[model samples]
Target: PLKVFNSEQIRNIGVGGHSGSGKTSLMETMLFAMGETTRIGATEQGNTISDYNEDEIERQVSINTSILHGEWKHTKLNMIDTPGFSDFYGDVVSGMRAADFMMIVVSAADGVQVGTERVRQMADRYHLPRFYVINKLDRENVDFDKVYHELRERFGKKLAIAQFPAESGPNFTTVIDVIKQKAYKYAHDKSGKVTEEAIPGNLQSQVNKIRNELVETVAESDDTLLETYFEAGELTEAQLLDGFKSAINRQMIVPVVGVSATANVGVHSLMDFIVEYMPDPTRRPAIEQDGATRKPSDSDPLSALVFKTVSEAHVGELSLVKVFSGILKTGDEVYNPGSSKSERIGQIFLLNGKNKKNIDQLHAGDIGALVKLKSTHTGNTLCQKGKEFELPPIEFPEPLISVAVVAKAKGDEDKIGAGLHTLHEEDPTFLVRYDGELKQTIASGQGELHLD
Candidate 1:
């Protein structure tokens, strides 16, 4: 959207999970449900909004993170869809750094995975509040309870079931939201249209049990809420809602939501929950560096962090940045603390995969792209001169595999060297260096797919 939103009206969510957990599909369903797209797109079809690149479409896997946006209930949601493979794990680190919170997706059929645990650890390290979305309920052998228990076993007992599929497999058309205590039956045509219904007769007891557990989870975090719950035997809807949000902000309640992205079920309710319960960008504390605290406020001194870089066909190099403080205006001069150089601010644009929406300015707590910076690269902080605050750089993981490389042709040595640097700039996890002992160039990464 071209309209500028304040920090209070923004939610920066980093979406991540296992490789086949249907993260891309989940992103597509959200965009469609938010009215940003005409219809849902499938991963197998290669037309999804998140996996738009040729390499990703050819392999039917996400290779890089795609920055996407959608307006839900007049609140701007800036989503970072990170790749699930460990090969491109650097993207997940950047996503966590840029997000105000994390949404960890898990496949209903697969349960927990290596990547799932990895992301949970990263979120804990960053102290970011997160929830789990159990996706692919329409797939065969999907068990929502099994996945829920697995998450509780690994994550914690504080993991509360927010929603669950009424029936799984090919007929998963309805999901019950524990908070709303209502059922949502969605259409099967990928239109994301749903009709509200009462709680099913057979599922009422289970829903009640889950709702009670949610109330208990929230009440445990506040003594006043606990006393009220004991005195009244049950909390009113308003009290429970406020307690739920407070518990979530304190990380005392970890909610699990069930969805079938392919069937376009339960996706809208998920967004509604986010708008109702999740904390806004203003809730997150500012990044403190150089004895300066950069809050997410338009009136504060300017500070922005470049977390990633990509080279578009006609756009040249685009630096994806998150404004941690103050407003970023076009044609302004900013200083790069990391590079110790002055860089001119150019045009700013909002992105949805390959598509770009031109905007002249970005408010604090918003993420956008700045075109053609001379001295700034990934992990650099841009701010007003003499009011310096260097944002902490994303700590990319160490490479797990290495290989020797050589030019295929005799005259292509310089070309190969230059190409590797460009690729390294795009992905810091992929490292290259000349081994003087072997007199050869060695390239390393998380795995063979990353090197290839």
Candidate 2:
């Protein structure tokens, strides 16, 4: 395993979509394909890495933003798996703030829904590079063409198909890569093995048409490519690939791919596409505060943002951070401007779901967790003592539901108070207040499950 990664070799992607859209399944497939897990664990069985929390297992939904990572083709992919329900949208906001790009998972059978648009708006707000994965293609009556067209109409014409299903429903086994102009058929055993084949004779015309559109989209991103396309009437594959990467980074083109996460079809192609087209952390916009920008580079002064705080059974408080500039090493002293306090960092761990692997240092554009900070909370900036700047705090929605807390046993009120305070520290979206008029302790959250 690579102990450290440079800025260009790291890709932070936020996996978000509506409930039951198979975002977790897609993440599980990616981890399995990358050899991070020996076997793919299903969410229903409560064995998946990301949804390991007890609450998640009982609810069968992601309650917190899970930080998961895997190395694909030597490039480290840090995936932020977020909740889809509106009640837990605060987690989605944090995931968006931490990711360099977003992969919005949409169900082919369901097409575009309310949660899909909500996540799209969040990505747009951050101006992150976006892509679409139309999942569950093996389900009965699934229509790739319909979803593809609907995405273009709803999002924009800049949305283009990078890969499409060769067939629908149970027969869905092959995907035609528009960029590569090749068809890949998945094996019968669902091992993620694919046999390359030429484009089907009947689909050749359609492929050519979409391929041309893709070429045009790529060419328009660069002046040289556009002039060459006009002069030569075409572009070579090398030129198209170079321009496509640039176009994707500049947000000129949004590529859509098809996949069946459960069937393990087209997932390999999707992972390859991410490595090929998704921009690295350096290519993304710099971290800015008060008109000061910190580009992603190890040479810059140390600066990192604490995006999440999790309390474990024994480890205590763990602050998850993304290094926006310079490097963070274990035992370094940094100041948190939000908390107006100084703290010493202890051990730094690269997060894999609930698991943590110790690492000596984390460079710019990397995400990791530090244990036992003195006063830093979520949305705080930690940097060199004299060089302090804060990133914008995540905007969480106001609580819409409220409930009164009453102790079942006398003298347990102090315990409940302490527990509520701890919960508030862990989740900023949860609010607790002592109602003087009602003479009750009131707890509020976006919804009932949050309070629960």
lDDT of 1 by residue, 1-452 (tens): 47888888898999999999999999988898778788888889889988988889988889998899989999999999999988889889988888988899999888999999999999899988889999989998889999999999998888998888999999999989998899999998767789999999999999989899999888887999999999998899999999888787778888889998878888998998888888887778777876769888898999998999988877888999999998999998999988899998888999999889999888989999999999888899999998988888889999999999999999898999989998888888989999999999999998988898
lDDT of 1: 0.90
Q: What is the C-alpha lDDT of each candidate?
A: 0.90, 0.90
Clashing pairs in 1: none
Q: Which residue pairs in candidate 2 have backbone atoms (N, alpha carbon, C) closer than 3 angstroms, thus clashing?
A: none
In candidate 1, which residue ranges exceed 4 Å CA deviation? none
Residue-wise C-alpha lDDT for candidate 2, range 258-345, written one tens digit per residue: 9999999999999989998898888987777798778888888888988888888899989899998999998889988888899998
| Distance from true location, Cα of 389 in model 1, Å | 0.8
Question: Model 2: how far is 218 from its true place, Å?
Answer: 2.9
